[model samples]
Target: MSASERYTFREVTPADLPLLAEWQLRPHVRKWWDTAEPFTAQKLKDTRVKRWIVETTQRPFAYLQDYSVHGWEDHHFFSLPKGSRGIDQYIGEADMTGKGHGPAFIAQHLKALFEAGVPVVATDPHPDNTRAISAYKKAGFEVFGSSQATQWGLILPMKVSSSS
Candidate 1:
């Protein structure tokens, strides 16, 4: 990505369900995500999770969701500080991965959250998901805890601070 590259996120709408479902079933995405079933217009109306279809002005290519770490009672990221958010996302387009879109878009989104007064951003990726770990590292996230097994699966907790 270049310094001038642009990224944006728009709230997922009911009209986006089919495309999201299509993406969720792709080999590239299906390997890491299983989000197709509950992805209805009603799911979009949930106030807790802020879901977005990630875009690059040129086109949309991914799905991303961020929510308060404490929103769920037993979430792996529950120990993060107040106002901290946890994110899960995947590139829908096979061509978009390995091209730096993950880090670039994630960093841009983190910047927006930080500017909006979020003190920290956290993510817990499967321990073996090297691609995701690498992208999060490039986005300024650092591993902060040992990997643990939870309802979400085995995750290696990672985080980035607004002040960092």
Candidate 2:
């Protein structure tokens, strides 16, 4: 079945911490989502970001988050219009990778954000993460400009404006 038909999202909760931590340790995930410490429910609550668990018909297999660019620490992205939301996500299950799920799920999330009055959605992936960059492009995001070095690493900023 197609990813659009198999994927859905649910709010992340304390009960999901173990699964989240496990995913965080996965080699594919760790390569891009580096952190000195393990993920915890308390850490998630303390942040302003909104997070979701991406589920397939069979089981949960990914994590996703959306936060306001302006609300985050001052960055080049703040130069964009206000209410622009930024996204970060990954398919945690190794089996789920390379199956077009990333773009499908991202496009679904973007539609919901736009419908909810967000004017734009953005994502910044490490320039070397070709898989992610390709998925973002397929999901309708366009590279807004050149790559920029950030504390997180070098990122290629991309965005999708609401049709409204």
Candidate 3:
């Protein structure tokens, strides 16, 4: 579908944990993950994974994965300076791919984050994923530069500078 079509954002919840876990196990999610391997059985057992469900459920948007902690590094890419929400997102559903929802979805949240006092927001996709790169650009993120790959991390910094 084109970006003109409508979509809704649902924050994650405890009730959604099983589904989230299932999604985590998908090859698509695993492909771009920061982890070198698929999430381990013990890793899945960890209580912290549940937090992605809780925090996003409370927030104004859906989470592709957690960004408030653990994921983003302390650098220009993940850093929000003073007035930013430091948000991240993903389109977890396989059916949602190549449909133009990602740019619109991200554009919505990026605007929201800016309104919430964010001065900048950044996301990094795999270097080889041109589709995601295009979607990020369509959402108004501009590439900054490249960095060394970390685990499943690839791609470069694509950032939006807020007007606040």
Task: Provide the overall lDDT of each model, using Cα atoms, as 2-decimal numbers.
Answer: 0.89, 0.86, 0.57
Which candidate's lDDT is highest? 1
* TM, every model: 0.94, 0.91, 0.67
**Backbone clashes (count) for model 1:** 0
Candidate 3: stretches off by over 4 Å: 1-5, 34-62, 65-80, 150-152
Candidate 1, 64-147: lDDT as tens digits:
999998988788777778889999999999998999999988998898899899999999888989999999999999999899
Model 2 Cα shift for residue 45 (angstroms): 2.0
Model 2: per-residue lDDT, tens digit, 83-154? 889999988999999998899888888888888988988899999999999999999999988999987679
Model 2 regions lying over 4 Å from their true place: 1-6
**Pairs with steric clashes in candidate 3:** 83-117, 83-118, 84-118, 127-155
| Model 1: per-residue Cα lDDT at residue 11 | 90
- The residue-level lDDT of candidate 2 at 96 comes to 90
Q: At residue 139, what lDDT does model 2 achieve?
A: 92
